[model samples]
Target: MGLWFLNRPRPIKRTISVILDFLAIPFSLWLAFSLRLGEFYIPPNQQLWIFVLAPVLAIPIFIKSGLYRAIIRYIGMDAIWTIARAVFLYSLIFSVIVLTFNDLAGLVPRTVYAIQAIILMLFVGGSRMIARWLIVKSDHHLWKEVNAVRYIPPVLIYGAGRAGTQAAALMKLSNQMRPVAFIDDNVTLWRQQINGMTVYGVDQLAKLIERFKVRDILLAMPSAGRRRRSEILKLLEHYPVHVRTLPDLMDIAEGRLEVSDIQEVDIADLLGREPVAPINNLLSKNITDKAVMVTGAGGSIGSELCRQIIHLSPSCLVLYEASEINLYQIERELASLALDIPVYSMLGTVLNQQRVEMVCRRFGVNTIYHAAAYKHVPIVERNTNEGIRNNVFGTLHCAQAAIDAEVETFVLISTDKAVRPTNTMGATKRFAELVLQAFAESKTLYNKTRFTMVRFGNVLGSSGSVVPLFRDQIAKGGPVTVTDPEIIRYFMTIPEAAALVIQAGAMGKGGDVFVLDMGEPVKIVDLARRMIHLSGFTIRDNDNPNGDIEIDYTGLRPGEKLYEELLIGDNVSATEHEKIMRAEECVIEWPALVKIIRELELANKHDDCQKARAILLDTIDGFIPQCELSDWLGNDN
Candidate 1:
């Protein structure tokens, strides 16, 4: 019973540490009397009867300081400060009692106050420190070992601040990884140690790597912004060691530190986020107390849009999605949010013109955001016809319905892929942009019915992006695949992408093709290695034999490129939002665009994959097919 009670961490027992301090109140009183006088003296009025009610006075003081709730092991300087403040005030009240009781008995000496206060504080404070010391001593043996049989690996963390220390403690608990050292950028911290791990300078990475044979370096610099991280990544680039980084401070797991939540750094960090200063009034102006509709609401980009829009107090938000499960997932989230505004989950495809028109008319949707498209490169490479139908026709269906419903603003979530492309997916999206560009070109275009497009690069962690692929491969315990390790692409967070889209949609004056200012591109190989390292693994290559993960290059896929360009034409002019730009270029008239779209639609309907590929190349500028045999694909079909 005694062993179990000692081992257990309980709320009542945690309070017991504080209660022990109150038990010393008698000594505190005795010392107070002794200090005011030259020696211990008990007045006739201050007989032992005062000690009987000491617990009553101490309980309020302890409760006021929030001392009872303070766990001894976790107590730090802040708690000590609170204790001092509470004790000083508590002493004043106790002294007042002495004065009041003097009316009943004889007077108490003033020197007694000084001795009592000093003794009381020492007793109360020393008990907590003693408890803390014992707890630390008990856990000392645990701080020395780690799990080798478990899935955990050995790791050395960077930084010794809040983020780093928390990460170290968490890694220890999971027993999946052991933290060997802390590699901080601060020179002063280099010789120091945290949690028994010596801190080293950033420059000593190679030495540390060689000495400990450390497999991975986990960056605990959650406070590091994009620019700083980019600089760090560049410095560490040539080391041939895998690198991983913590998520942005705000995004780190509910502001709690845990090892299982420790994730591999992905490409998002390389494309450091430039904070968005939203045109808030403009964004909330249209949606507030107005009916809003989002097409493709179940998609990664579209779902985020819904999440933000719902918070803006739209009179009613309608989520129009074709996929059943996607709709259910997003709908369940909104339902749980319990917002006052009506949230309707409508099942309907954007490509179904009549279905879209009916929903818009029925819901009285005043605002529309179009985000549906086939985005995968290799998949879209083969299924060219379906890609065009969904990209081009799906967009057309939603746009015309919004027009017929007299919607206020229609924002098309576009991509850098729409830029002059080598792939059919890019060409189809360019054609869709043209579909809006032609509608915007009309002399009859209305200020009320504004249409616009926001173009940016791949979003990190989106359904088809490299981040998830790298993460999954890393988890699978072997080779992490990259298509041409040198392939570079721009990346952004889904929320950042959605924010830009919302801001761009509001900025549009109809038919404007706005491009998001994506920061510098990141190489795929570096991204892979960082992910491997952050996941507590070293990359297997010529330099490291203990590496747990292997990087394999599969060569570029069909219709894919080493890089993608955001600007289709050089005539792009900056917008009000520095990150957004408007592009001016040649456009096929709506008549011609419609003609191409019709043919493309028919090709998809008849399964004429060759004809679909043929029309895509002729219609879109800068498109080149890696494979000429449309018939071979059709046969495989």
Candidate 2:
């Protein structure tokens, strides 16, 4: 019956509080008189009006103070403060009324009014505290009864700041997990209590995990930098607990998310470097009020480029893609995000010179970002002719079209694999770079298009990236395949990469090759281990036979290198942007490059894979075939 009444409608509960306050106010005055007189004294007829006036004055004050508006179960210090102020005001008015009436009807001691104020304050404030306790206890009891069979895991919050306290409060209301304590790096916070959870030093992590049986740690440091987060993650990785983090501070500040909206640790945090803040001037230099187009606009890098470009307020945006579904998806997304900016989605391949040129002319394109290519190494290796046709000739078609349309800027998205190539894909990418370099130097197309190439290594979350592949393999519950234990690759978040690309494009002189500073190389095997451990899984190996995930080294695939390089040679110099550098690498002159393109075109036209391979080997200085030709069609020839 008590629980049912407590669970009554909010208005009914509020009315109950009003009735309680009404009865308590009069009773408090009577108690105060008795205490002051040192006997069981009843109010005389003259002072009887005082009892009625007490409630009449106090109830309205309490209501006006918003005392009843606060939810009883969630009441805090602020509500208590409100109660204090409201009661003091009511006491002052009641004392004046009593003193005036006493002068005419009956004598009332001055001490009685003071005593009444004290009693009334205690009754008003203490009752709400008591009610809050009762409501909280009842809800907790009901939750326990209903979820008796549910097992709520005990977890630790890793910060004791405001975000951490909010997360703790959220945890108390949730049935999924129970917060055990807090782990903080601040020594001053250690051994302190926050939101009913004890803060402990890093040294106490092992003990806390053991004592509480904690299987997860919630990182509530939303404002922490990537390097600091990486340090903390490295420390946490030593434990058996799975880790999750709240979104960035901006997200929380914008009200897009709450501290309790925790997600799996962002893989980018493991990179140990803060993303360089983008320069607004450089970001909008070529894009602002200029008609811009992005090829492969539906791809990982291409889509992110589109998202960033729209925010720069272009005159109009054009999305050119070969895949119909990719074009439609990106077009819909850009339409919503573009707002007032016009977004034109064109479905066509870069291989068609006429189509590519016509789209540029129709859109009045000022800048073109060429991202379409056969990027998957093994897939491209198996189709050498198709790889050359798309990566090399396709790039040629786009550059020629941009030149014909007199586009102001043409930025080619090149890969680290293009440096000192060993695969058909890399060779073709290098060839594509040469195509742009040759065009930039050509006298005939001089000053028509400022051609630039931004070269960088793997981007996290891009299509065919190892990060997602490993995550999927881990989710499936068993073996995670790695290409080689020794292989290492540089990684940057896709957004960061796209931002840098935009900035690099703005900084371009004709034929410039910009290399983005991809911080440090990470070993593939170590990355695999970290992902497994962070997911709360142990690696299965000779050392640990009873582990959750087994990492299997599949050896390097065809054309895959042990490590990737951003520059072909060491002729690199810093640019205005700290993360971007200009590489003074060799380039083929137009006449020679034109001859190479014609030979490759004839080879592709005849499906003569050997002839195409020979042209790439002879033209690209560092091109080295890593294995026998594996082209599915070339094998028969």
Candidate 3:
């Protein structure tokens, strides 16, 4: 009950503080005099009222100094200065009173007044410091007791440089985390001391973890490159301790450093792909001062392309999306950014040939980034006709509209699934690429529109991405699902992919199929285990059935592959950009491709799922359906 009262409200705490100061002032004065005289001294009647009135005089001054407003537990060294200032002023007032009264001046010894003033300063300043210490320590003890943990988890900070030292000093003051030692890659800094904490080499990490019982590692190499950081994370992945990385040097330079700046290791760290600096000229080549339009502008890839395009100083941006909510969301976000560029959100699908042509011509669009398509493999597999219509015919109509509108460039966002595909989604994406190729080579009546296709694998954090799924499953404290142990995927961040797409589109000399260099594919099973371990959860396997998270293998989904390829042929050549590669693949002539497209359109129009599948299988080279029957369309029959 007393504890409850103490914690009731800020006003109660402030009131209690004022009362304590009143009682302490007179006691401090008496103690000061007794200490100065080296005996139990009592003041004479004439000067006695001065010591008694000390509280009345000092309380008002302390209150004015805002002493009671500060939380004792959170008070810093600056509070000591406040206490000293109030005390010094009070001593001066007392001296003035003594000097004004002849009786008081004669009663108090001159040497005693000087000694009392010094002692008074100590009592006043020391009281607050002691109170702060007591409160902080008490709170720490209470928190530890409630947690039932025998010891606060000591964190070992990696990197013994300036950033690491600062992080260690900051973490030491944290009640929940204690900084134990430093682990640096520098051999010369090993065995050195920073703030009295020993710094050890990376070789000693295992021994130090065991010795100090380190529960987590704080990565503070803010200036380290992505390659070096990835190496450190990979090494730490084998350890049982949870890994956290600090914000980059930009954040530190902006004075945003905090305990919360330490974030969990992202999937990008595990991807181990070194980020390449984007070329400015390439990024803004076709976009600067030009009207740009992005179909499916609300989808993951499309939305990111829109974001990147706006920064390139496009004169105007037209967001053409099939989903009203998605279109509104991107439009609202762009509006909130308050960019000078004009933004027009058109609610229509790429399938609407007339609408696509109208939007292109209405905006005088210089470039069209076609990202509209059915991308999810299983969903597309279950809905074959819709997938082909959207992915295949959708690309055909959009490209045709671009040509008619005399657009300067048209870029189709293709996927790795399009390479020697086993899935209808991949086959449709491949067909979209073929459509662009056919258009680029055709004898057209309209102005020649440069048609380009940029193909890459999965992007991290996009819709239907496994990263978010694994994260959600881990957060729920359950069995994380893996499609197959052997399944491997190439992942890139959305921004990087968008940037590459823009650059690749700029390099296109019509009919060019550019494939961005997707770094080494990551195994799905390994990815799941690492995610669980990095999150401070143990994998529950046959040997450790009692562990935290269980890994469940659900087998592959429909139209899914164990691995995906970025290129269809060995005729791949490096471009000026090291990350972007150009591929030369066979393309059907305009006459043949137009005939095939017409048949595909008629088949889709009649809802002939079997005929559509047959056309895709026959038209696309090396295209193989997982099965002969259309299971999803049986109900329509």
Query: Local error of candidate 2 at 393, Å?
Result: 2.4
Q: List model 3 lDDT by residue over 120-164, tens digit each.
A: 667656665676666656655665675585566789999888788
The parts of candidate 1 lying over 4 Å away from their true place are: 1-15, 35-46, 102-107, 142-155, 168-180, 193-198, 206-213, 234-255, 443-448, 529-551, 629-632, 635-637
Model 3: colliding residue pairs: none
Q: Number of clashing residue pairs in every model? A: 8, 0, 0
Residue pairs clashing, model 2: none
The global C-alpha lDDT for each of the candidates, from Candidate 1 onward, is 0.77, 0.88, 0.85
Residue 353 lDDT, candidate 2, scale 0-100: 91
lDDT of 2 by residue, 143-256 (tens): 687568778888899999877777777777776678889999899998888866799999999999999999999988989889999999998898888998888787767745
- All candidates: TM-score: 0.88, 0.87, 0.76
List ranges where model 3 is wrong by over 4 Å: 1-154, 160-178, 191-198, 207-214
Q: If the candidates were sorted by their lDDT against the true structure, best first, what order would they fall in?
A: 2, 3, 1
- Name the lDDT value of residue 279 in candidate 2: 87
